[model samples]
Target: MKQNILTGVLLAVIALLVALPWFAPYFYIFVFTEILILGLFAVSFNLIFGFTGMLSFGHAAYFGMGAYTTAMLLLHLDWPLLYTLVAAMALSGLLALVIGFFCVRLSEVYFAMLTLAFGMMVFTIAHSWRDVTNGSDGIAGFRISEFGLGLDLVMGNPAVYYHVTLAIVVIAALVLYVISRSSFGLILKAIRQNPERVAFCGLNVRSYRLASFVIAGIFAGLAGALMAPFLRVASPELMHWSLSAEPVLMSILGGTGYFMGPFVGAALFVLLETWITSYTGAWMLFLGIVLALMVMFFRKGVLGTFLDWWMNKND
Candidate 1:
C-alpha cells in the first residue's frame, strides 16, 4: 500500500541519519547528537502540551532530576551506563508523579504557573545543595564506561558515544510513538479536547493527565541522562527555567500536533543556531526575530503548516 511505502521511505531516511557519522565530518556528528537529544526532549514536552492541553513551564524539573541522577551515579557510584540511565528514569518519573498529582488539579495558566514554581524549587535545590550537588560549579569530569552489552566501549570516543545516543533516542522515540497511538493516548486526547466530557464519560481525566505527565517526564529524563554524559557536566543549569523553554520552543516551531514536528524543529533549531552563531555574535537577537515571525504567521508551526499544505493539495 501507499502507506507502507511511505513508512519504508521514512525508515530509510532515519537509518541514513543514524549512520550519518560514518559519512559526514566529525563536527557534524556532535551537532547530530544535540539534535537527537533535544528532539526527544521536545517530543516529550509535546505529550503534555499538545495532547493533554497542558502547558508546563517547569518541565525542566524532570530533565534536571535525570541529569543529576545520572551524574551522581557516574561520579560517586561509577555505575555502568545502563544502570545510570535506569536510575535517571526512575528518579525523574517519581518526581513527575508527585508534582503532576498536584499540578493536574489545576487547568491552563494556573497549571503552567504551578509547574513553573515546582521547577524553580528544583533549580534552587541544585544550586544551593553545594555539599551533594557541587553547588553552582556542577558535576564535571564524568566518564562513560562499558556499555554492558558484552562489548568493551571506549568511553572517550565521540563517534561511539554519538552512535549510542542515536540508538537510545531512536528507541525512546519509538516507544513514545507507540504510546501516542494506544487507547490511553486516545483517552488523553479526549481529555484535552474536553476534560469535563471525559470526566462525565467515567474517565479519571486527572489520572490520565498524570500518567501522560509521568511518561513525558521519563523521556525528558532520558534526554537529560544523554545530555549529562554528552556535555561532560550536570549542574543547576539543567534545572533552570530557560532550559525548560527549549522543548516548548521546539514544539511550537515544529508543530505540536504532528509526531515528527518537534524532531524536525529541533534539527532546524540546532543547525540554525550553529550556522548563525558562526556568522554573528547576536544569534539570540536573530533567533528572537525568527521566533516572533513564527508566532505571528506560522502559528501551526513549520511541520504543521507544511502538512496542512500537503494534505490540502492532495484533496
Candidate 2:
C-alpha cells in the first residue's frame, strides 16, 4: 500500500513537471530547470554519501569538472551539446576514479578530509589556471549549436531548453533509480550499514565504494553540463567547497534513506530560496534556521517524516 501510494505520488509529480512549462511564467520555467539540475546533482551526491556511507566534502569537484569540460568543448571544439555531455561524464568519472582510489582506502572522517583536500586541489587549479580555465572568471559565451540526433530544435528558446533539460533529467533520474534498486545498490546499502560484515561476506567493500563514487561523479558531471548551458557560464564558484555542502544539506533535508530524498530536498531548498530572496537579503539566515529546525524535529527529512506519518495513520 505504501509503495502504491508513493508510486502514484511520483507519477502525479512527473505529470505536473511535464505540464509546467505551458503554465509557468518564463522566470519560473528557468527556476524549475535549476531545481531539476540541482536535484540531479544532490541525488548523485546521495549515492556516495547516503548509500555508500561516505561523507565526501568535495563532491562539487566532479560537478565543476563537468561544467568546465562542457564549456571548453562548446567554446573550442564546438561539439554538439550531446557529445559534450558525454565527454563531461567521462572526464568527471576519471577524476573521481583517481580521487576515490585513495579516499576509499580510509574510513570515517579521514576519508571525508582527504576528499576535501583533493577537492580544494581541483579548485585551486581552476582558480589559478587562467589560460585554459580562464581563471576565476571561468568560461563563458559558448554557443549552443546542435543537440545532436539531427534534431533542428531552437536551442536558444527558454521553453525549448526547459523541455530538453526535462527529458535529460528524467532519463538520468530513471537510470539512477534503477541503479538504486539493483543488487549493486543493495550491496552499497549493506556496506553502509556494516562494512565489516560485507567484507566478511567476501564482497570487496572499498571496491564497491570506489564504484559508487565514480558513478556519482559521472552523474554530477552530467548535472554540471546541463547547468553550464543554462547559466551560460562555467565559473570556479561551481567547484567551491561551499557548493559541495549544498548536496550534503539537501540529502539531510530530504531524507538520506530514501532514493528520492535528495531531489525532494533540492526542490524544497530552491523553492524556499526563491520565495525568501524576494523579501529579504537575509535569505541565508532564514534558510539556516529552517535547516536547524528540520534537523532538530524532522530528522528523517520532510518527505521521509511525512511518509512515516502517512503509513502510521493508515496502519
Candidate 3:
C-alpha cells in the first residue's frame, strides 16, 4: 500500500513538473530545468551510494565528460541532439568502466579516494588541454541548430528548450526508475546491506558494483548532456570536486533510501539557493544550517523521514 501511494505521488509530481513550463514564469522555467537536471544527477549518485553502498567522490567526471562530449560535437560537427546525447552516454560509460575496474577493488574510504583521484585527473585534462577545451573560458556560443524530427524549433528559445529538457528528463527518469525497481536493483540493495552475504550467495560483489557504477555513469552523462544546452557552457567547473558534492548533498537531504528522495532534495537545494542568494552572501551559511539540521533530525532524508512517520502514524 505504501509503495502504491508513493508511486502515485511520484507520478503526480512528474505530471506537475511536466506542466510547469506552461504555468511557470520565464525565469522559473529555467530554474526548474536546472532542478530537474541536477535532480537526475543526484538520483544517479544515489544508485551507488544509497543502493549499492559505494560513495563516489568523483561522479562529476562522467557528468563533465558527457557535457564536454556534447559540447565538442555540437561545436565541431553540428550533429543532431540525439546522436550527440548517445555519444555522451557511451563515452561516460566507457570512462566509468575503466575507472570502476580499479576503484571497485577497494571499499569505503579507499574507494572514495580512488574515485576522487580519477575525477581530478579528468578535471586536469579539461583544464590544461587549452587547445581543445578552451581553457577556463569553457565552451560557449555553440549553436544547437535543431532538435531533429523535422519540427521547426528555435534552439535559442527558452520556452521551447524547457519543453525539450522536460521530455528528455522524464524519459530518462522513468528508465532509472525501472532499473531501481528490477530484480537487479533488489540485488544491489542486498549488496548495500550486506556485500559479504551476497558474495556468500555465489555472486561476485565486485562485478555487481562495477555494473552499477557504469549504469550510473550513463545516466549522469545524460544529465550532463541536458545541462550543457541549458548552461550554454561546458567547462572545467562542471568537473570540479565541488560540483560532485552537489549530488551527495542532495541525496542526503532528500533521503537516499527512497527513489524520489534525490528529486525532492534537488528541488529544495536549487530553490533555496535561488531565494537566499538574492538577499545575502551568507547563503552557504544558511544552507549549512539546514544540512546540519537534516543530519541531526532526519538522517533518513527529508522524504524518507516523512514517509516513515506518515506510514507509522496511519498504521
Candidate 4:
C-alpha cells in the first residue's frame, strides 16, 4: 500500500511536469528547468550523504568542473551539447576518483574538511587560471546549435530546453533509483550503518565509499552540464563552497532517507526562493528561518513528515 501511494505520487508529479510547458507561462518554464537541474544535483549529493553516510562540503567542485567543461567545449570546440555533457561527466568522475581516494580513508568531519579543501583548490584554480577559464569573468556567449544524435533542436527556446531537461533528468533519476536499489547500493547502506561490520564481512568499505563518491560526482557533473546552457555562462562561483551548500540544504529539506526526497526539497527550495525574493531583499534571512523551523520541527523534512503522517493515518 505504501509503495502504491508512492507510485501514485511519482506518476502525478511526472504528469504535471509533462503538461507544465503547455499550461504554464514562459517564465515558469525556465523556473522548472532550474528546479529539475538542481533536483538532479541534490539527488546526486544524497548518494554520498544519505546513502553512504558521507557528508561532503565540496561537491560543488565536481559541479563546477562539469559546467566549465561544457562551457569551454561549446565556446572553443563548438562541440554538440550531448558530447560536452559526456565529457563533463568523465572529467568530473576522474576528479572525484582522485579526491575520493584520499577522502574515503577518513570519516565524519575529517572527510568533510578534506573534500572542502580539494574543492577550494579547484575553485582557486578556476579563479586564477585566466587563460583557460577566462578567470572570474567565466566562459560566456556559448551557443547551443544541436543536441547531437543528428537531431536538430531549437535550443534557444525555453520550453524546448525545459522538455529536454525533463527527459534527461527523468532518465538519470531512474538510473540512480536502480543503483540505490541494487546489491552494491545495499552494501553501501550497510557500510553507512556500520563500516566495521561491512569490513568484517570481507567487503572493502573504503572502496564502496569511494565508488559512491565518484558516482555522485558524475551525476552532479551532469547537472552542471545542463545548467551552463540554461544560464549561458559558467563562472568560478559555481565551484565555491557557498554553491556546494545548496544540495546539502535541498537534501536535508526534502529528507535524504527516501530516493525522491532531494528532488522534492529542490522544488520547495526553488519555488520558495522565487516567491520570497520577489518581495524582499532579505530573502536569505527568511529562508534561513524557514530552514531552521523545518529542521527543528519537521526533522524528517516536508515529504518525510507528510509520509509519516500518511502512513500512520492509513494504519
lDDT of 1 at 9: 72
lDDT of 1 at 191: 85
Residue 194, candidate 1: alpha-carbon lDDT? 95
Tens-place lDDT per residue, model 2, 8-101, is: 9999999999899889999999999999999999999999888999999999999999999999999998999999999999999999999999
lDDT against the true structure, each candidate = 0.90, 0.93, 0.91, 0.94
The C-alpha stretches of model 2 lying farther than 4 A from their native spots are none
CA lDDT of 99 in candidate 2? 95
On lDDT, the stronger of 1 and 4 is 4
- List candidate 1 stretches off by more than 4 Å: 1-5
Q: After superposition, how far is residue 265 of candidate 2 from its true place, in Å?
A: 0.3
The regions of model 4 sitting more than 4 angstroms off are: none
- Cα deviation at 149, candidate 3, in Å, is 3.3
Candidate 1: C-alpha RMSD to true structure equals: 1.3
Per-model root-mean-square deviation over C-alphas: 1.3, 0.9, 1.4, 0.9
